[model samples]
Target: MSTTRHYINLTNSLFPLPGYAADGYARIKGISALVTTFGVGELSAINAIAGAYSEYVPVVHIVGTPSTLSQADGMLLHHTLGNGDFNVFSNMFRHVSCVVSMLNDPHEAATLIDNAIRECYVKSRPVYLTLPIDMVQQKVEGERLRTPIDLSFPLNEQEKENYVVDVVLKYLHVAKNPVIVVDACAIRHRVLDEVHQLAETSGSPTFVTPMGKGAVNETLPNYGGVYAGDGSRASVRDRVESSDLVLSIGSIKSDFNTAGFTYRISQLSTIDFHSTYVRVKYSEYPSVRMNGVLRKIIARMGRLNIGAGFKPNNTLPAVEPESSAQTITHAWFWPRMSQWLRPKDIVITETGTANFGIWETLFPADVTAISQVLWGSIGYATGACQGAALAAKELGINRTILFTGDGSFQLTAQELSTMIRHELKPIVFVICNDGYTIERYIHGMDAAYNDIQIWKYKDLVAVFGGVEDKTARTFQVRSKTEVEALFSDKEFSAAPFLQLVELYMPKEDAPLALKLTAEANTRNNAKA
Candidate 1:
């Protein structure tokens, strides 16, 4: 863990963050630490921690409690629940926490801290620890910290690997049209290399879920488009559904990830390779780790001649439309932006219109796309952009790009201050329509409730601590010609420092897929 410091400090500590923080953790492949004050801070952060627990993301929440003397005297603290008991907050965290600890005694503090960290990594869940002011500097044995934490899931029976591999290879040999479906957990499990090798070795078409977008090199020869059942493109839906066999790696089948359970693949011909288990057809091999199996599969790729599977058709064009009629519609803008993306750029898309529109983009090679698909939380992208930019900054990679709607940006726009504070530079493209366009498509198309006040987006950075030309700059483009010209400009495209672009289009402009999905969700919600 880097001990430098966190990017931003929320005044309320009630920010919408579980998804945002988890978004960074997924990309960095490390534990995220969220610090807070005693009762008020802990309780405010509890829900986000619980969300992390639900999604199997590792998070360590450290809370600063009252001093030992105050707790010993049972003095009521300002942030407390207004009672004598401090144990109430700790006990509440226990229900959602994988491990809970309070550092009151020095003798046991080291063990408790080590065990908490170990459990969090092992289970990939959240842990809670309360540190009293008095115990902050207590001395403990340094030798204990030298021992490495064990993360290996070793199988007791030596035959388990051989048995599972033989069965999987046997099915692969006979499968005519095998397809690889890479999900979000593949990123969390850190098997993207294996995913690439497996897809290439099998000579099969590869598709990524929304949560797993950019996990694979989308420019691969056999790369297919995003496959979300009815939400998918026409060609993508047909090709994926027609596959004789589906190989799901680190799969997560949440409602939003699966387009509200619209996937039509049969379990009888599906093979599921999870973190700790593998399922072939209806039979499952318990404790069979994917980490080992992926290595063995990659090693034997040359001998298997797995190219006998179905050949994929490259349906997505490099550039679909060369000319637009001066109007910026979803179909026109997405394909055009696809041409604008560059390699090594880290892109973050907001929920609603940006998320749906991004699905239509063909990312350049080595680009990483970040989104909160399952969580479906608005205002998440701005915070996630800050974290991802910081990660990219740490990696010495510039060109952090963001695509967001105006409504979503307003919810968490304060995080822009954090980005400026760190001297981090990211290009933010704000889609400026007049209202909550996504919500209007879902429920009320023209309801008064959906409207929001218009702000001078180009002037926002001045209020948010940006010094134009020196540290920040903003642009307003209302037409396709103007937008294209801005992108083509050497100065704007360089993205030398922080930049924001306010893109204006019609209020009703949205991808057709989001509209359909929203309609389905509205119906589903109405039923209940």
Candidate 2:
């Protein structure tokens, strides 16, 4: 009955890639409802659901199960544990999801469904719901449907919030040099307006973590740069590290986000705001939530203003020429590709080379850049591109651009078929380097284990049901000159159809940041 109601919104997939589907839904900030058959189908997507949980993307995994009678009779059906324990999958889901529900009674179905969905939005994490085959035709009362499930924000203690704000004010007022650093939680928690308000009102140099790149506007006058600890540009590192006070919002201090814990900041001068708490030096305010606290601080901006002695010099220095000769390099491609993007374009970058290389490019305002820096999952961006494109379509936006390496693309490239099926127009740029450049940089630079079987990437469009000059088109370019012409070309840039650009680069070339971090990671791995 539920499927019948939303049949128009439904699209069947070739596999149970809940990971890809969940990752895709995460990009658009939408709730995913993935239907899978019991055991075989459900387990296929369990790993993806776990990824979604780690990244705070909400997805409802609905499982169609065997008959209730089979469970009662202890019948060892296909796709079961053979011991008649059908609860194993449900038990596993409890670890990854914030909520789990099963429809056993028609009278309880409506409330369970509502409550599970409410938790999904409130927590912003995946949920698991199970439906026995026998419950498929059950009817439930609609009386409670009028009252919407309460998904309102939980309030922190007003007194505690005020106390934290005053402490933050004291630090802000005395600091000669102040800066604002944003992280992933700022994007997920929906307090970006508050982050922007604080930065604008404070007139501080603002920078984003690797995960928080597109959350805040980077074109502002006081914008410092991307702050990835030692991996940051020299000027940005100097300004941020040398600051008298650092106000970090939604900060996730992961190894990747912090460039292998390379950040050097005095905790005494740092005020950290998170989704549910705030930390000032050694003192932790447990109930002081960022959403309410940030909103309150923005409201009191006039009184909290700390004028004079705090000025940020935002200058963008150009890197040296990527190629003295006419060769396509990582440094060269990303910077040039920057100008090719338009406003409101959703850009998804895969892990490894694309993830690291994209940091060099300065994104324009209103252009969203999506990448799994913290997850560091290869092949995620392709599936995420599918999600972003569909989300853009629903939101009436154009252009879903994706940048993925050859190794990662090969992992989940089947998602392109889904995009073609749904008629989503995304311009996919597959970085065709020979092997895993990131793995090579980390351990064995010349190991055969780092290599992959190369496929004719350009021919995929035809195999995936993409018609030339109609729903899809493919391009393979090998040189700087050809890439320059394609990016500069008005028609190609528009990409009115689902387009693929197989970009061939040097087998060993990697982003400068990746090379540095790979060495650090190697040392860390050696220690472990």
lDDT by residue for model 1 over 228-250, one digit each (tens)?
87888877787778877788888
Clashing pairs in 1: none
* TM-score: model 1 vs. ground truth: 0.90
| Cα lDDT over the full model 2 | 0.79
Best by lDDT: 2
| Candidate number with greatest TM-score | 2
Q: Give residue 431's lDDT in candidate 1 (0 to 100).
A: 91
Give all TM-scores, in the order shown: 0.90, 0.93
**Per-prediction backbone clash count:** 0, 1
